[model samples]
Target: MMRLERGSSRLYAMMLILAVVVLLADQLTKFWAVSTLSDSERIAVIPPLIHFRLLYNAGAAFSIGAGATWVFALAAAAAVIGILYTARRLASTGWALVLGVLLGGAVSHLGDRLFREPGFARGHVVDFIDYGPFVGNVADIALTCGCAAMLLLSLRGVPLAKTPEEETA
Candidate 1:
């Protein structure tokens, strides 16, 4: 097994912390939405723009593949695994942060699918915060931001880790 250097360890710690924060925020907000909001009522935060409404989504974005909740659950599990695998060699702080947020959101959704109502591996995701087009939860926000950051970092030619050739140079 490749041991992490001190800096790499610190980066991993930061990533873990960020992921925990995102997971907590997502869960707490979902709890609040479930307790306070009603499915039948839309609480407008900004008239015709933003609203708070309870939504139980069993599928991916925009309710696509509604009938395949298990598929989404499996996909999320696979994504979490992939992210963790990538983290093993991470050498960039930016990548650490982005992956942390992404991991958190993915884990949150996976948890919802595995544990929350209906049945195991077929539970619906709790979502609120209507953005005039789609309703999503905190996890979605984190995922979106993380993805954007990932894209930006990639565009800037930031490497996730130093290649063997680069390290020797």
Candidate 2:
């Protein structure tokens, strides 16, 4: 059984806050895109590199499995569950933030899958940030950054938590 440290509550609260902030930002940006942009419109914010182009993605990243809406939904659900489990074990603020961002991103995309175009579970995710040949949303950015943070932490050998033996080492 894993026992949480005395300071874990504060970290957990921070994580929850981070998750909510990411969710709100993602939803707000997507809502704006959906309400303001036409399906065929592309607004360039940075020439040759970035643009705000509304895209309805029914698949996972990069448009792979383009028509597999249910598959993507399931994957997002699994990611949320995994994040929840990992969040409880997180011993550092960095891990908490990363998990929160990841969870928020998953939830944001899942919300679109349940409530956006088409119908529940078959709805498409609204993507607007277009850079190069790839189009993504705020949620995708959060997830990507969170994954990178996790990778960096792992490479630095940041102690997630000490094992029982290691605690005594």
Candidate 3:
């Protein structure tokens, strides 16, 4: 287990808050889509650009592995566990925010897989927000942005945890 430094509570607080907010936004939007939108009809938000088209995807982007919902569920569960484990050593606020977003996306997707239609661990993810060739939900957006930011941070050499000497400086 990693030991937390002084003021680490603030980092945890930020992470938790961001995660909850993202989760709520993703779920609420999906709820609204299910309640108001139709799988057979599309609502145009921007002609030929963006729109809302309800879809239950049983696979990853582009509907890859359409027959393997359980596999995706397992992957999402693993991602959630991994993020939580890494969060224990977080020292940078940016990393905290990014991980929180990633966690929220992963958890929301996992919830859908565990509770939505079809069956447990075989449920399809609720996807909307059509973008010409793609359709996905807020959780997907969060995950994409979080991953991009994480890559940027890593490229910049941001440490996940502060060293003992750095803590004293």
Candidate 4:
């Protein structure tokens, strides 16, 4: 039991490290994109398949909101809070890792919205990396993968919530 506890501790540390690395990489890549690409301009890395297309998204994934920057910012904040709360409750290493990734990605994009273009929380998220029709960023990829991981875990019967009765039982 002691050994298992140690192992779990190590796993948690590893997950935290992975999250930090993801956040750093995402931020760095975004900085590069902002510095290199002009707004709304695309530089093709591979014609029609992959390109570094600079875009400002004032909405959720795929620019869903289109112009409601404040709403998106609020939503991102709520997501970050929810993820952090979930992370605190996570016992499984896999869940921790997934939450970490999701949190990191959220933080990265949220940072951009708070500090980048258009001013304060009214700012837009900078997105690049156009693969054919879809354009996203490193943070977006992390969020997607994290969400997928959580979904997979849920599908595989990994319990996400533990009630008081279950804990006592």
lDDT of 4 by residue, 4-123 (tens): 234445555666677788889988998899888988687878886899988878788778876787777777899887865554334577777887788788888888888877799888
Clashing pairs in 2: none
Supply the TM-score for candidate 1. Answer: 0.94
Candidate 3 vs. truth: CA RMSD?
1.8
Q: Quote each prediction's TM-score.
A: 0.94, 0.90, 0.93, 0.83
Stretches off by above 4 angstroms in model 3 are 1-3, 163-169
Please report the candidate that would top TM-score against the real structure.
1
**Residue-by-residue lDDT tens digits, candidate 2, 1-169:** 6455456656667788898999999999999999999999989898989999999998888888878898888888998887776665457888788888988999999898888779888889999999988999999999999999989999998866435554334
Q: Which stretches of candidate 4 lie over 4 Å from their true place?
A: 1-15, 161-169
Instruction: Give the C-alpha miss distance for residue 133 in model 1, angstroms.
Output: 1.5
lDDT of 1: 0.91
Candidate 1 off by > 4 Å = 164-169
User: What would the per-residue lDDT of candidate 3 be over residues 32-111, giving only the tens digit for each residue?
Assistant: 99999977999889998999999999999999998999999999999999987777667889989999999999999999
Model 3 Cα shift for residue 53 (angstroms): 0.2
lDDT of 1 by residue, 48-101 (tens): 899999999999999999899999999999989998777766779999999999
Q: What lDDT score is found at residue 35 in candidate 2?
A: 93
